[model samples]
Target: MKNRSLRIFLKIALSTMLLTCIRPAPAPLPVILNSPVGETITAADITFSWQAQQPAAGYIIQVASDSNFRKIVVEETVSTASANLHLKTDGRYWWRVRARNESNIWGFWSEAAFFILQRFRVVGALKTQGYPHDLAILGNRLFIADGQAGLAIYDISIPEQPRLQGKYLDSLNVAWGVKARDSLVFLAYGYKELVIINAVRPESLKITGVLEYPQPGYGYALALRDSWVYIAAGAQFIAVDISQPAYPNLRFQYYYPRNCRGIAIENAYACVACEQLGIAVWKLDTFPPRQTETFDTDGNARGVDCRDGFITVADGRNGVIFLQQDQAGHLTELAALELNGYASAVTIEDTLVFVACGSGGVAVVNCADRANPFLIATITSPYAYKVGAIPGTDYFFVLDRDLGIVTVKKEF
Candidate 1:
């Protein structure tokens, strides 16, 4: 009986010691130190701070544009409780933190703290059947270059609510770029070939032509002028003669060192956006197009547009670069507009320059002054992939990777 009592006493004493030794979970929830719970922050640079728990070895901070943390845009782990972040675009964002101990003991995620960036508002949104890569508009019709799903046509007579009129779903064709003129639409496939469609009637569109490329993935971006179709595809600037839409003949192919993204033409000159190679200018009038002048930029040149003697290029990450053609037809760098993220697409409307910054938003720049161009107004979106102006309206279409196409008017 005495031994039994002694053993029971020791067992109780050990249980008490273990209960005391166990450290309470190191601050399972961190208290947000800066910014109000639901305040709008104008500055793009954001700093997140939390209380450092007693035994925390490190802290992880996660921020997302969505509330459910579905897509964590920025995530970082630091020893301290404070972390500075560069949030993309202007919109509502949610953030949360979790703590970890030296022994790799992770604490529960803290309650989410939310904030808003009111730089731009959503005018209109539509969800496409598949990923909308590129689009072209003629009259009130919008032809979308859909990935995997082939071609999709929409009636944008009423820009607010775009009615899907017809679709040609091709499981084999992965469409990349599109250009619409008159009743004809030129579609570029991801792997190869350029398909042409005659859409005189939206209800019944027909495939009228098919152009095959020498390179498998060479049919990416295209610019059509009458019978000549200039392509910025893969690592080559290809000129296809489509005088007869049904029969496309490859006339010229200019291979650059880097991938080509956009192509623009002026008279006999062709300006190609050669990714890292900058803007390559070629004399297309020649039998074998000869590269005349090349303009180097700080960014990855993705798109180019030129008129009269002025040139504008969407230089990825480095923003927009404006160049002017001199009296001798030499290109000279004039001005530029600096943006936060990748400048993916650019369109010129008179003196206004519209730029689509990937996840950075869309900026309207007034380039009336070639020396000093300034932003007019910005349309903020986290997935601003491409921007294009409507043929004759004060409206512009911004394509989002997930949100389909967003229509915005030139308010400013």
Candidate 2:
């Protein structure tokens, strides 16, 4: 009787082990929402993300104009938990996701989430004397470089209604570019070189110091980093020391082949938009800044801005050109966005790019995907020459050659 019981128990144990080895795994859990749940999205690309479901081979996402998914706009299967898409029109959108098991069986769809897509709008505009070339925003104040009218200051504490606070007019030279920090304002004083103004009292602004570019060069655009100011001039890229505000000094100069229209400083390097020569990169940490690299664009490379290892150029007839910087600081062209007008200048606020399109007005571009930039909208202006942003906010001012300062606000 004992031998028979032992044999039966061994058989039962073997059968249990086989059953466990052949048993099927449990199905993946239902998809859960992660973002864009009843929120207002202002960008060109909308991202749909969800909690990952284990044992899922893929996922099917559906986007529609209604909660019922009757009028579907997007229905695709992706191998990941997130999907990024660009919608052509701005309106309300509802989306949901469902997982697909390894056996190709679809799971239950998650509860639908909704979002709104809206672009920016022009809130207000103010006219200025002479040509409005460049602008800068410091705190609640807006400084404009008005060609022959010199520098104009306005209070933008209230964006919709800008009030003029002060003005500085020089009969000898024109103000081409302007940048401000603290209680001082830096002006690219045309053929007169760099002029520093004491804006401690905005209502009665006065010149504090002036540094003339070594003969043959005229300041057009300027970029400020720390105590150094890099200026894109007529025939040379000039650098100035502003450590002592009242006594500005010219530091270094790099011979540029063509007219330098715009300059942007990023970390330890300075990139200049050299009219016909395209874009030139200079290393700023050296005794005398050295030109490290150069890239040619399809059209006139008028303006440039560098951030997060990427460079954006406003190519006159080509619209916008995007470039990627490698670890060694070498640049490679990624893509080009063709626009309707001549792109003279560009400014970046986070992932959005605002371009001053000569006759096409101001073109807003979404650069969330650096490799592929898309147009968000184009605000109509008689002649948009340059663009400037309010630091971290969506509030930006377009320097319209004919309209002066145009304030734009992004509604969330």
Tens-digit per-residue lDDT, 1-412, candidate 2: 9999999999999999999987766656679999899888888588889998987999999999898999998888999999998775466889999998887778889989999777777888888987999888888899999999999999998887889999998889999999999899999988877899999888888889998744748889999988988899878888889999788888887776769999988888889999889999888888688788899898999999999889999999989999987756689999899998999899888888888999999888889998888886778899999888777686788888888888888865
Which regions of candidate 1 deviate over 4 angstroms?
A: 1-121
Model 1 backbone overlap count: 0
What does candidate 2 score on TM? 0.73
Task: List candidate 2 stretches off by more than 4 Å.
Answer: 1-86, 89-118
Clashes of each: 0, 0
**lDDT at residue 88 of model 2 (Cα atoms):** 57
Look at candidate 1 and tell me the lDDT of residue 113.
83
Task: State the lDDT at 224 in candidate 1.
Answer: 75
